[model samples]
Structure formats: C-alpha cells, structure tokens
Target: MTEQVSAASNAAVDTISRAGWGAELRATFALAWPLVIAQLAQNALHTTDVIMLGRLGPAYLAAGTLATTFLNAFLLGSIGVVGAVAPLVAQARGARDIKAVRRVVRQGCWAAIIISVVMIPLLLQIKPIYLALGQDPLATDMAEQFIQIAAWSMFPALGIIAFRSFLSAYDATRAILVITVLGVLINALIAYTLIFGHFGFPRLELRGAAIATLTTNFIMLGMMVAYVLRHRRLKRFNVLVRFWKPDWPRLREIFRIGLPIGLTVLAEVGLFTAAALLMGRLGTDEVAAHAVALQLASMAFMVPLGLGVAATVRVGIAFGRGDIDGVGNAGWTAFVLGLGFMAVSCTLFLTAGTFLVSLFLDMNEPTNANAIGLAITFLMVAGIFQLVDGAQVVAAHSLRGLSDTKVPMLVAIVGYWAVGLPISYVLGFVFNWRGVGIWLGLAAGLAAVAVVLVARFAMRERLGLMRSRA
Candidate 1:
C-alpha cells in the first residue's frame, strides 16, 4: 500500500509540472506574437524614416538618428511609466475586479498627461545640450527642427500607451496589432510623399519624418480612445465615468510603482544615448554607423521586448489568482522564449551583418562605405549581447508583475550608469578603443543586469510561493 501511494504521488507531481510549463508556453506566445507584430510596426516607423533619409546621404541619416536618441531616452522612458498599468490591470482581471481595473486606467491617463507636460521643457532643451556637447552644428540644427515638430506628439503618444496597457491586460491584443499596422503603413506613405515632395506636399525632409510620426501618434490615440469609449464589452468597466475626477491615492500608488519603472527605463536608455553622444564626438561617420546598427538592433529587440511584456501580464494574472508556481512558470517560460529568439538574431547578425548593413545605405556610394563598414562592426558587437539583453528585460518585466520595482530600478542604475558608462568612457576615449569599446561596455552592463535581475525574480518567486503556502 505504501509503495502504491508513493507511485501515485510521483505521477501527480509529474503531471502538474508538465501542465505548468505547457500553460505558460502556450499562454505567453499566444499573446506575445501579436505584441511582437505591433512593436515591429511601431519601430518600423523609425526604420522607415532612417531608410528614407539615408537616400539623402550620411549627414541626413545622422540628423534623424541623433534626434531619436534623446527622444527614445526621454520620450520612450516616460511611456514605460505608463506601462505600469498593465500589471495592475492584469491583477484586477485575475481577481475579477472591474472597478479596480477601470480606476487604474483613468488614473493612468491623468498621469500620462502630467508626464507629457513635464517632458516639453526637456525636449526643447535637447538642441542646446547637443550643441554644448560639441555635436555637428548642421546635424544638431536638423535634430532641433525635428524635435520642434515631434515634441508635441508626446501627449497623445503616452495617452495611447495607457489604453494599450489596459487592452493588453484583458487579452485585447489584436486591437493593437490592427491599429499598429494601419498606422505604420499610413505613416510610411505620408512620409515618402512629404520627404520627396510628391502628391503636392512640400519636401520637408527630416522635419517631414517628424511630422509623419506625429500624425501616426494622433491616429493611434484617437482609435484607441474611440474603442474604449464605444465598445459595449468595455463599457462596463466605466473607464470614462469619472473622466475628470482625481483620485489622489490611486494616482500616488501608480506613481509609486511607475516612477521606478520609468527611471529604470531611463537609466538603460541613457546609457545608449550617452554612447551615441560620445560617438558624435568621434565624427558624423561614426554617429551614422552607430545609428544604423542601433536601429537594426532595436528592431530585433522588439521581439524579446514584446515577450517580456507578455510575461508581465501572465505573471500578474497568475499572482492575482494566487498561483505562485504559475508566476514562476510564466516568468521562466517567457525568459526562455526571449533568449531563444535573440540567439537566432545573434546568428543572423554574425553571418549576414554586412548584407544587413547594406540595406540602409547605398553600397556604391564611396562616401558611405566608411559608415557601412563601421555599422557592420557594431552589428557584430550588438549580436554578442542579444541573449543577455533579452534575459535582463524579461526578468525585469517579470519582477514588475509582482509589484517589485524599486530593486530593479536600483540595479539598472548600478549596471548601466555606474558599470556601463564608466567603462564606455574609459575604453572609448581613454584607451582609444573608440566605438567598439563603447559597445563592449554596453555588453558587460547587460550581462551584469541579466544576472542580477534573473536572480531577483528567482528569489521573489520562492518567497511568494512560501507566503502562499503559509
């Protein structure tokens, strides 16, 4: 009888383990594929702009690239704060609490607006700082003009993100994919027309790219808001009912969770932006090469990024449902998927890097050969870090699902700013290793962060399971 009981227990444990991993893999990729598509579409806007401007020459490419570096640092980081709502919404869904979910959404909108306002002065100040940092005056001037047009779109952009988080939590992933495809296609056509002065539009060049991007932001915002306002299913959430009412406590809670997230994002972005700035000190050719490599890397990065976000939703829901094992399962599953995908990216970057670099520049142009050659080298460096970068981002998002924000924020500071930046400066300038050294430092920083954050989530998962059992 004892032998039979032991055999039964072993079988049960095996079944549960299979079930956990199976659910996590299916659930995670189900949501992640659509998210990856949406992210790719959104990033393609920048890619399209860069490709179009590349036709004008390396100088034009540098202008758009330089402007986007600061824009990504400040603007994209602020949007990351808005994403804090995803976990909150997912938790609410798991608990079957509609009112709590709606409350978070409305509060998030207000936070987005407030944050957008704070960003204006910062965006306006980019040009002066770029000049002081000794960037090419012509490229800096072009970057300034792009910011002038692009800055105003921050409000709607953040607003779109708020709704996006809400929708993702409820598994409304298809909505974003549809809207994102439309936005990117429209932006590309409009950008081509405006940049080339076709269809009666004046040739606006780099500024036209800015305008095209801004137009898409507004379109996305309007579509998302309209869906929220009119959808019969979503109406019960009452997202618009207290549209103007302020909930200070709720707002404070979001900021408490979100500011850390924003700062974490800011630190990582700042590291790369700083590197871009340092490259600027080298020359326009180096900056242009860095730009192409970074853009390509960012494009491939969206896949792991989307998977990481899907993990946040999965883990948060599992947490709310009081399934601690499920949280670990979801987190680990996503991490595996993310790292796997990036490894494939690594192989591509290693094998066909020159061919990939050729897509962004005119190979026949003798002037661009230097920049293209430099980009291929940086692409190889980028390939080396893809696995670690994927793992770190996935781990960070998993932690976010557990309302564990502060530690990861601190880790980002230590990893990126302290460990990464100083090494970059020492190797690139002091040791005269140049651009390659800066990218090496970046790889070291990502590896450190991956180790730290993955360890944090592992510890947290055990603690959460212990508490649940208690």
Candidate 2:
C-alpha cells in the first residue's frame, strides 16, 4: 500500500511537471473537499435507502432497486442539462460577467424545471415497461407504486441540482454542503420512521422510502431557493430576479452544450441501468447483488464525481481566463486526485469486498446469502475498472469545462453502448458468465472510455484547441 501511494504520488508529481503548476492544488482541494463531503452525504442518503430496503428482505431491495434504476436513468440523464450551469457560470464568473452568470443560473433553473416536467410521465410508466420486459409481476407492481410517488420529487430535485451547480461554480459550496447534511438527516429519520412504522408513522415499506425521499427533495429545493435569494453575494446574481423573462439565445446555447452532456450521462447510466435490469431477469438475488455492488461503487465514485465538478469549475475558469497552462494543470491535477482516490478504493474493494457487500445483506437470513455471494463476485470485477472509471469521468468533466460536449457524447455512445453493452450481453448470456460477465463488460466499457476520453483531452491540449478557442 505504501509503495502504491508512493507510485501514485510520483505520478502526480510527474503530471504536475508536465502540465505545469498554474492550477493550484491547494485552491482546488479547498473548493473540492466540501463538494466531496456533500456528494458523500447525498450518496449516503441514497445508500441509506438501499440499507433500509435491504433489511426488509431481498424482495423489497430488488423491487426498490429496479424502480430507482429506471427513474434514475431518465432523471440523471436529463440532469445533464442542469450540468451546463457549472461551466457556463464558472466561465462567466472568470470573466466577471455578472449578467451572464445571472442569466445562466436563472435560465438553467428554468431548463431544469422544464426537464423535470417531462420526466414525470416517463417515471409513471416504469411499471408497464417492467411488465413488458417480463419482470416479476409482484416486484413490478411495487416498483410502479414507488415510482409514482417518487416522480413528484423530480421537480424539486432538478431545481436543487441547478442551484447547487450554480453555487458550486462560485466556490460557495459550504452552504450547499450544510443543507445536504440536513437533507441526509431528514431522509434517514423520515425513512426509518416510516419504513419501520416507528414514531407512530405508517410502515409503508417502499412507499415510505419514496415519500421520505420526495419530502427531502422539496425541503432541499426550498432551502436552495431561499439561500440563493438571501445570501448576500448570491443574491447579487439575482437568480430569482425575473421568473418569466425570455433569454432565447442563452437558453439555446445552454441546450446546445447541455443536450450532449445529457445524452452522455444517459448513455453511461443507461448501461448500468440495463445491467441492473438484466440482473433482474436472472432472479431477485441477482438483482439484489448487483444493486449492492453498484451502490458501493457509486459511493466510492463520489470522490471522482466531486473532483470532476471541481475540474469543471477550475478548468472552465481557466478557459475563460485564457490560461492555457492552467487548463492543463487543472484537468491533469483533477485526474490525478480522482484516480489516486479510486486506487485506494480499488484496494479496499479487492481486499474487503466480501465484508463490504456483507454490510448490505443480513447474514442471518439464509435467503440473503445468495445475494451476498453474488455481490462478492461483482465487487471483484468492479474493482478492476475503478481506475479507468475515474479516468473517464474526470477527463469527461474536463472536456465539459472546455465546452466540448458533442464529441465526448459521441465517444460515450460508442464506449458504453457500442462496446460495453454488447460485450456484457455476449459474456453474460452468450458465454454464460452470468453475474460476473456483466460486470466484466462494464469494466471493459469503462476502460475503453477512459482510454479514449483521456486521449481526447490530451489531443485537445496538444492542438491548443481548448486554449485557442477559449
């Protein structure tokens, strides 16, 4: 482990020398840690849902997992639209263009609201789709109910993301962090009380979890809206200034950049969601295992995701400032941090995967043993792709900062769907590798994406396109 750390440190030092030291690590970390904590808190909130559902037995876990998987495939994919806020606002902030920042945030929020409205109907239809796909009728029915209740949360969730992106771009991450902590606490308490019928609440099971999540979404959005409206500096952006103004050109620009990001996110998330659905076809136990392993992977992924957020800001700012060296430094530094962090995660997954997966299952429940067993297998394959997953995500976000979305989107389509999905289907079904094969396919896809994405960013730098265009 020490030697691994030494090698990772040496690699970072080497990257710093080549990339130059203009993008400050200290500044980046300062901006990044709070964001990381907030992301962990959010994932922890979601994992809490998994843990709570898991305790109810594999049926409950499988049902909730399947439903959320479907909803997230759409919800997160659309969120790619709100993601435009960070880079758009950061670049505007870099140029100290107050009007541009305000316009972007307000317009971005409008975009989120519009996207949320469209997502609701899609979520409402999850059950029929599940049935059409031949999922267990009982599980499909329960999942459908869950999505119906959960669908309402998307409106506020989208709003929160938009505002959160705006705040993150400005380095005002702490307020968002505090609210997220409160949200997790709220979600945990509400989920527990309602799930177990504690504190005189109804034991609505899956419905209770959705209600808790939805309730948190509303409150979090309220807090975000309030914060933006009241915070001295944030208020200066006038995010809430005019609710009905039309900025046709700016909205078009945002959609132009954001649509590809949305598709890219959709493509990647669609792969995993497809994997989850495929696991369901195998059995409840398979789905349960896949859910557990994916949740852990997601938790670990927050580090890179947060770094990616920071990279978007730092690199976007550098781009706006016309700092060629800073763009290289920011992007490379984030890649180093993200990959190095995931290296530690890979070690943990490799060394203690059984124990980690065990936390999501009840060892005493004999029925859950299957899930635990399958999850252990998946974690090993998950560990294999940790570095590459980090590589792709970090590099992708850096490109996003360059406002380079379309090509990256194309790269993702080819990498995840073209390469990853086909391979997963072949290995899992064709070769009969089953659970393990599905994960291997994911690893392969991510590895391909990592190679191509990093190379793409490198080429952009070499050609001076990122700097010259900015």
Candidate 3:
C-alpha cells in the first residue's frame, strides 16, 4: 500500500509539471510549434481539396466554395460551442482540479454530439435556401449534394475536436498534431482514389471529396477515443463511461460562456458568406475570384489562428494560477508573433499577387481574365486586412482566456453586420466597385473588431488582476 501511494504521488507531480511552460520565449515556442504544425496540416488538406476540385471543372470549384461556406456557417458554429472546453480545462489544470477537468471534457463531448445532431438537419435544409437565394441552379445542386454528404461527418469531426480540446488544454499538443496529420493523410489518399477512380473504385466526383472528408473525420474520432482510453491519465476517469454522466450545472455554465462565442463566430462567418453572395451576383468569374482570394486568406489566417489557440491556453492557465502579469505577457507574445507573420505574408502577396493567384486559377484561359483581375485586386485588399485579422483573433482569444464571450458577440454584430455588410453591399452593387470594394468593406470591419476586442481584453485583465489581489 505504501509503495502504491508513493507511485501515485509521483504520477501526480508529473502531471502538474507537464501542465505548462515557464513563461520564457523558448518555452512558449516549445509549446506552440506543435499547434502550428497541426494547423498547417489542416490547412494543407483544405488547399489540396481546392486545387483538386479546381482541376475538375468550374462547377466543381464553385460547388466546393458554396459548400464550404455552409459548413462553416452551420456546423462550425456548433463546434465552437464546445470550444469553451479549452479555457475551462486549461484553468482546471492550472488549479489542479482533476475532477473538474475531466467533468468539463466529458460534458463538452456530450454537448458536441447534441450540437452535431442539431446541425445535420440544418445543413440539409440549406439547399432550398440556396435556391431561394438565386444561386445558379447547377452550382446550387452540386453544392447541395456536397453539403448533404459532408454534413453527416460533423458528428465525428466535432467529437474529435472535443477530445482534442481536452488533450490540448493539458498541454498535450503532440497528440493533436499526430491525430490531425493522420486525418489529413487519410483524406488526401481517399479523395485522390475516389475522385480519380483509382484502385477499382468508381469515380464519385464531388461526392468523392465529401466521402473522403467524412471518412477522415471518423478515423480521427476513433483515434482520439482510443488514445483517451489507453492513456494512463484518463484511465482513472473511465472516460468511455464517465463521458456520458451529464452534469446539468456544468452544461449550463458551458453554454453561458460558449453560446456567445459560437454566435460571434457565426456572425463573422455570416458576413463573409454574405460577401460571397454579393460576389455571386457580380458574375461567375468574380465569384470564383472571390473564392480563390478567400482560400488564400484562410491559409494565411492559420498562423494567427494557431497562435490564438496557444494564447487561450496560456492565458487561461496563467489566470488560474493568479499570475496577472504572466497572462498579459503571454497575450503580447502571441500577438507580436502573429503580427510579424502577417507582415511577412503581406510582403509576399504584394510582390507576387498575380503569380500566387495564377497558381489557384487558370490564367491562360480568356474566360479567366476577369477572375484573374478580380483575384489580384481582392488579394491586395486581403493583404491589408491580414494584419487586423491577426490582431483581432488574438485579442478575442485573450478575452476567452478571461472566460469572457458576451461582449465579443456584440462587437462582431456591430463590426460585421452593422458596418461591414452594409458597406460591402453598397460598394459592390450600388457603387459598382465589384470584388475589390467588397473586400475593402471586410477590411474595415476587421479593423473595427480588432480595436474593440483589444480594448475589451485590457479592461478585463485589469479587473481580473484586481480580483486576484483582493
């Protein structure tokens, strides 16, 4: 018995030691690189899908764009609801509350499942809405089929995200990297085989892409579940069993914190999706150009997105530890790093905008001349926004670290809807400025969000520090 107690005590100490870095630059990088790699892998799969679909036909390309928009607007928001798990789990780690940590994760997974079930039907209903919105019939039909198939994967994908959030909050980022890499690889292989009719499989076209993504999600979910089951740390919780024990109070707490963030995410996505609609009205080439520009911008955003995730973990842990200075320092570290990266991206795009745009589109075709022109203009606009985009995401994440979400939603509504969407519509249609005008509106909105979120974080940090002192 004494020997067993000694072993258990050693294990507890090890877990605590692994919970965080020492607030040093090197230590921060050591914690952050894995997250960056995971984000890169995820982005690579998205880029690959676009490249492959672009090769198929213009209809396929357009369908992919529309389908992706629906996925982000609907299913992605639901998953964001579970994103509340991260800071809470990280804080629990900081406070050494193992039971609370496990409970948060388990309830989060349950919430994700419920969310996925709700989202699947909403995605199915989007087809009629697309038709109602006057999307080109062929494009709308292809997008509907793709969304229907892809929406089914939300359950598994979100389950994977829930587990990933659990592991990452404990600073086990390597597991996330491993799982995401495997999923991306599987997606690539399956997408290639099915899309091209390889290995005696029938060519499934757009459906193949959807199936590949779906299969990859299932594989990721299984891998995460298996990891949790076999891992020593989670074995105590009997995660398979414990994950189902619904804690109503914790669920309410999670909803209180998460719903606003989810809505804020939805609101931002709604703005961009609405911009896509406005672009669609401009013409086919312009819409395609908009899609290409958005894709590249998304790729660029991954760096800041990963940094934001790291910032949330670091800030939450620091807050839990009552280290006000450490929280502010971590936020600064992530923000500076993200801004520096965006500066590099801006320079690269400015120098090679045409060349970069050409890579994703067929510039040699006369049909693409308008697209090429529009894409370059949009890329230029995106270059300006990337700076503010990075800053705002980091700022919003800093607020997440303080477990604040409500004010950000209000900021998103005003910044994106009240300001950005109206400006986009006017410049694109009324002023006839086209895609560039719409993009300028997006930049303005992002700048607004950046300023507001930064101020909000500063205020919250002061209050949190005061409370800690008290």
The numbered model that scores best in TM-score is 2
Model 2, 252-340: lDDT tens per residue? Answer: 88899999999999999999988987887788889999999999999999999999999999989988888776777888888888989
Error of 2 at 361 (Å): 0.6
Per candidate, the number of residue pairs that clash is: 0, 0, 0
The C-alpha RMSD in Å for every predicted model, in order, reads 5.2, 3.5, 8.7
Q: Say which candidate scores most in lDDT.
A: 2
Work out how many backbone clashes candidate 2 has. 0
Write down the lDDT of every candidate, Cα atoms only: 0.87, 0.87, 0.80
Model 2 spans with C-alpha error above 4 angstroms:
1-15, 18-23, 462-464, 467-470
Q: Which runs in model 1 stand beyond 4 Å of their true positions?
A: 1-18, 461-470
lDDT for 373 (candidate 3):
86
Stretches of candidate 3 above 4 Å error?
1-22, 462-470
What's the TM-score of every candidate structure?
A: 0.95, 0.95, 0.92
Error of 2 at 46 (Å): 1.2
lDDT of 2: 0.87
After aligning candidate 1 to the native by TM-score, how far in Å is the CA of 341 from where it should be? 0.2
